[model samples]
Target: MLKISSDQALQLVQQHWQITGEINDLPSYADRNFKISGAQGNFVFKIANPNWSYADLDIENAALLHLVHTCPDLALPKIMLAADGSHIIPLNLYDDAGNTLACHMRLLTFVSGQVYAEAAQQTNTDLASLEYSLGLAIGKLDRGLSDFQHPAMMREVDWSISQLPGLIDEIAHVEDAEIRALVQRHLHYFADNESQWRQTLPQAVIHNDANDYNVIVSTVEPDGDHAQQKNSNQASAHESDPVRAHYQVDAIIDFGDMCFHLRAVDLAITIVYALQHAVDISRVKQCITAILRAYQGVHPLSEPELRILPALINARLSQSVLMATRAFRKNPANTYILVSQIGVHRLLRQFEEIGADELEQLMLSAIR
Candidate 1:
């Protein structure tokens, strides 16, 4: 794969999208991305991995356009068409060995906000409220996309929860034998239950990668200024009572992982990330409940879906640690791959202690 440098990315953006700006490289798993700021306003320039087929790029672009048209009120970033009026720009880069590398690229208006992951770090923020907002936002997004369909949505993706069982061998990459064994046990559970989940859960076109990084929280607080002022007055009246800041979900980005799958998989992915850093089992349970309740308020989930959610979540967590472990083996110096390893292992152990039956009961109770 041809990795474009900051300079190359800037040039390509200027050439294809007619955007002239100072480009800042953005962190990516397998693609080259940059944040461009100029007279045309801020835009994100993304170059798809050379390995990605034209159909893949077409589906992603089509999904973004569909969302923009159908859910105009949503804070989804607008896809910027190139000078040629094409959503995707084709590029051919060369490796040092002079081999040809073909890739697809696109530009999108930059969604201005703090990433949900970063926003979660602020002590003044109400996390329960934020998680609720996240659930509601995702529920609405999924509802909007319910009617949308594309052939590319069925593309094979290793990260898909359905594909988690195949990664069992990756557990060998885990150095800690105890952690590996735990992951293996969960993998076995997922494998054993996969067929039943496939038969029961509600399926739809879902934004599969709703992890913290892709979820953007707008800087604008959801509570209006009146509420803030009221809270401020209360705090002034009693110095001990502090005002907590409430935020809203600004936008959801990165539709590259969008796929045809169980609607619950989206919630499972979100819950896995939300609870990754949870301090205790209670907090983990609380986060799950809060998210599910908010989602149910927007889009009620069926009991069968709820029953299989815990297993799907475990499957997602297992996918994370296994994939991270595999990536770590390839690039030992990359810290991003291991970002969730510690938290994932902790959550897995807690889940084992809680047992799947009780976990399902907890989720079922929340939605009820």
Candidate 2:
């Protein structure tokens, strides 16, 4: 893979896209990303990974275009065209060995708002409120994708919930023996229940990667007058009452992992991330219930899907921990991959104590 330099990125943006701006590198798992700010507004410049085939990029671009037309209400990033009216631009670069490499690039209008992960860190916001809003957003996104289809959607990918059982070998990459054992337990559960889940759940085009970092939340300013009035109404309220920040789902980003999968899989992925930072089991249950209720409000989940969700959620967390462990071993210095490692461990331990049967009943009752 050819590493893109700052100078080359700026020149590519200015000369080819006709956009001039201060380009800053953005963190990414594989692809190179830069945010360009100019008078026209901010845009994201993405250089596709060399391993990505033309078919992969084609499906991602097509999905973005389809969303633009069918779901105008969504705050999805809009793809910008090059001077030649091409959605994707090809670039020639030389690697360290002095060999030329073919690289693909594209531009997208940057969506504004704080990423949910960052916002959650700064606010004492209600967990249920945030989960409810996120559920509705994912529900609407999946609904928009119901009629949309592409050949690439059927391609086998490691991130799919169906592929979780196959990742048992990756557990060896995890350094912690306890964590590895926990992952193995979840894998066994998934293998035991795989047949029933496959037969019962409805599959569809799902936004398979709605992790907190990919979901953006619009900022909300606190109202002093309302706060003062509420405090006065409650005599026990003290001056130390923390001002809570409210948030709404602004946009969903990162479609690289989108695919045709069980409809409940999307919910499971979202729930795993939502519960990542949670420490209290009761609070985790509350957040999960709120998310499911809000999602059912938009698109009701079937009983069997709800029953299978606990296993799916466990599998998703196991996948995250295993993948993060592998990435850390390969590039130990990459902090981005390790961001959720601790939180995932905590969540898995808590889930084990709570038990899958009990959790499934809680989730099913939430929608009922």
Candidate 3:
């Protein structure tokens, strides 16, 4: 990864866009991203990875612009046109060797809110409302993207669930024998069921990576009386209320992983991350049901979609664990990758013990 300094990013923004602001680096795996704050307001400045061609970025920008029209009420980042009146511009930068490198860059309006991963950590927060809102927002996103099409949406992506089987060899890289076998079991299960996984299932453009950090939720301030009542009803809130009473899904970020795929695969990816904090099977079921129940209200899931979820969810977990292991081995000092995989092993084991029959029944109960 080429390190684009904050100074270089600021200089690029000044030259390309009319707005100027202080720039700070944002975490990115394959691209350079920064948050710019100024009088005009905050915005995201992205320098594309050299791997991403102009056509690839054009497809993504097109989808974002399309969603603005299709789901106007949804809080999505709007693409900001550069001073040239183009949404994307080519820029040349020099690496450490002083060789010129070409990259495409763009500016976007920043979507505001607490990231779901951080917001979920607040002990006083209402998990039920947040979980349901997460599902509802994803459901609407898929619905809006249903009619959208692009040549690049079908590009092969390494992180996609459809690529789970291709990662089987990576399982050996898992240090723990038991964990390695567990990953193999799920990957094998996915291979066996590959024929049915996408058979007759609805396919469309989906925000495939709904990981906790990529989605943002807005927190609602509780009035004095509401706060008092919330304390009293904390226990029952988990069972009764399905409304967005405490928190609401404000934005879904990082369109880098968006692709054309099975719509249910999108929901399955959401379920995997939604259960990251679960300490037990009961809590897992609670989160799963809340998401399913809310999602069905917006876009109903077919019988086939519901049945394949356990496998897809497990496959995704397996993918995460395997990929994390490979990444950690290469960079032992990056503990964040290891930290992200904390509860995945436990969740995968729990799902294995629950088995497909009962898991399917549990999901059925949600929509019933």
Q: Write down the worst ten-residue block by lDDT for model 2.
A: 230-239
Give candidate 1 regions above 4 Å deviation. Answer: 1-11, 220-241, 332-339
Q: Give the TM-score of each candidate.
A: 0.88, 0.87, 0.90
Candidate 3 per-residue C-alpha lDDT over 216-241 given as tens digits, one digit per residue, 9 for 90 to 100: 88876544533443443224334344
Q: Where is model 3 poorest over a 10-residue stretch in terms of lDDT? A: 225-234
Better of 2 and 3 by lDDT: 3
Measured with C-alpha atoms, the lDDT of residue 224 in candidate 1 is: 65
Model 1: residue 6 alpha-carbon error in angstroms: 4.7
lDDT of each: 0.79, 0.78, 0.81
Error of 3 at 142 (Å): 0.9
| Selected candidate, larger TM-score, 1 vs 2 | 1
Per-prediction CA RMSD (Å): 4.0, 4.3, 3.8
| CA lDDT, candidate 3, residue 344 | 92
What is the Cα-based lDDT of residue 204 in candidate 1?
Answer: 84
Sort every candidate by TM-score, greatest first.
3, 1, 2
Q: Write the number of the candidate with greater TM-score, choosing between 1 and 3.
A: 3
